[model samples]
Target: MNIVVCIKQVPDSTQVKVDPKTGTLIRAGVPSILNPYDHYALERALEIKAKTGAKITVLSMGPAQAIAVIRLALALGADRGILLSDRAFAGSDTWATSYALAQAIKKIGPADLIICGQMAIDGDTAQTGPGIAYHLDIPQITFCTEVDSDGTKVLVKKLIDGGHQMMEASLPALITTTMPHDYKAKYPSFLAAFHAQDKQTETWTAADVNADLAKLGLEGSPTRVGRIFPPPAREKGEIYSGSPAELATKIVEILKKENLIK
Candidate 1:
């Protein structure tokens, strides 16, 4: 089986900074890390590779600097890395971004399975994976917590509100994984790191992927960011200090005063 894993390079929340003028992230100086959710997807992909001896490819779309995340995937056990970077792909929302990625995967040719994280930290929209599946015209399973293989078919345990549902899909499908999908990701050894650093990743631009110029970047995005600002600060809590009965009366009084309870 040939497995394609999609990953993203996101700003480390601890070091995030915004561009005041553009109302966008200032990615140049911020420390970048692999999206935490993507790690579980990568781990699951590697586990599948280990069990079936399948070839694994890591794919990502971002600025040129995003290559670091791809190399990290290589160090973790991916056989190859593909970086989709270009001026045309800048400022793409989830829909356009997934469109571009789907084009790149088409350029990479056939694959048995595609894997991705449940969502990206930066956007957290959880739309890209399904968007890619839509673009690829393939069946998809989202929020998968467990995956099993029966040689020809893939069985996935999907997480729902109360429990998990098991479903089987044929090969050449896309899957988005969530927490505890597999064992914790392993640390890369020195040798793997060194080799990953030396590896030459395939780089593709919008043109290389045959993406339409009009539908490749911000131009293709239907949604626009009207404003970007931090959320309002939370108000201090009111504490009721007394016996249970008194506290209950005080809570009710406060709730009634706020018109929250009848």
Candidate 2:
């Protein structure tokens, strides 16, 4: 079975800042790391591989520096890594990025399953995974917390509004996963990291992947960033000291005064 795990290199959210004038990220000096959600997705792929002996390939699209994340995936036991980098792919929105990724996937050969994070930390659009499925015309399941496959069909536990749902999809499907809040990402050992250096890793360009130039980069993006600014500071809450009964009555009175209740 061939499993393709889509991962991304993202700016550390805590250190990221927006350029007030350009409404763009100030990535000049901020450290970049693998997106945590993608890391979880990769781990899930590894789990599936351990049981099924599936060949796992980690894919990413970014600048040359982005290969760091690919190597990290290699160190974690992925079979191979592919990096899609080109100036033409710059400024791509989720739609364009998905288009390019879908094209690259096709070039990589048949994929039995594709796994991705529920959303990227930088964009948080949660659209790319489904977009790739759309581009490939394959079934997809999103918001999955747990995933398993037997080389023929995929079984997943997906999170829903008030509970969870069990879903199954046939081969050649895609899934986007979300990890628990307390999940800790695993690190590769020194030996694994050294061994990863010898693994098969290749860098491909837009032309190499046969991606449609017209559907890549800013030109292909239908949406534009108007502006970016910090959210307004939150107001402090009122504090009161009283018995439980008194507090309940006080809350009722306040709600009534505020017209929040009749």
Candidate 3:
């Protein structure tokens, strides 16, 4: 089975810094890590491969630096890596991103199953995966907590409000994952990391993927960032200490004073 997983390189949230002047992430000094949800998606693919012997190809789109995440994928067990990077792809929003990736996936040949994280940590927009499915004109399942597939059919445990649901889709479909809380990401051994360098990675440009220039970058993005700012600081809570009866009276008075109770 040909399995494709889309992963991303994201700023390590703990060390993220924002540029005051531009209202942009300061990625230069901040450390980069594989998006944790992507890691879990990749791990899920590996788990399936363990039994089905699927050939996993890890694909990503970003600057040249994003290859780190691809190499990490190879070191973990993906058979190959495909990096889509070029000047034209810079400053792309989710719409343009999904367009470019859909084009690239077309170039990667037929895929039995495609996996992606439910949302990116930095953007928190869960739109890209569905966008890919739309661009590819394929069926998709989102917010899956667990996934399994035979060579022909894919099954998933999807998370929904108040409960979970089990669903199945045919081959050549896409699924986005929301990993379990106890999920742990895998890192390669030193030797495996070194050998991962030898694994084949094909780098493609916006043109190589046949992405329309009109739909490649900021020009293609309909959404604009009006302004970026941090959230307001939280206020401190009040405290009351006294006997139970006194505290009850105090609470009642405070509530009445606020017109919350009478």
Q: Deviation in angstroms for 167 in model 2? A: 0.6
In terms of lDDT, the best-performing candidate is 2
TM-score of each predicted structure versus truth: 0.87, 0.89, 0.89
**Model 1: per-residue Cα lDDT over 130-246, one tens digit each:** 999999999999999877654477889999999989999998899999987345666799998998787679999898999998886778999998766555569998766889999
Per-residue CA lDDT of model 3 for 1-262, tens digit only, reads 9999999999997777777799887889788999998998999999999989999999999989999999999999999999999989888999999999999989999999999999888889999999999999999999998999998999999999999999999988999999888888779899999898889888999889888989978899988776666666589989999999999999999999999987
Residue-level lDDT for 199 in candidate 2 = 94
Candidate 2 C-alpha RMSD relative to the actual structure: 2.8
Lowest summed lDDT over 10 consecutive residues: which window, candidate 1? 178-187
**lDDT, candidate 3, at 13:** 76
lDDT of 2 by residue, 1-262 (tens): 9999999999998888888889888888899999999999999999999999999999999999999999999999999899999999999999999999999999989999999999999989999999999999999999999999999999999999999999999999999999987899999999999999999789999999898899999999998888877666689999988999999999999999999999
Q: For model 1, what is the error of residue 203's alpha carbon versus the real structure, in angstroms, after optimal superposition?
A: 0.9
Candidate lDDT scores, in order, read: 0.87, 0.95, 0.92
Report RMSD (Å) for each prediction in the order shown: 2.8, 2.8, 2.5
The Cα error of candidate 1 at residue 90, in Å, is: 1.0
lDDT of 1: 0.87
Regions of model 3 farther than 4 Å from truth: 233-262
Off by over 4 Å in 2: 232-262
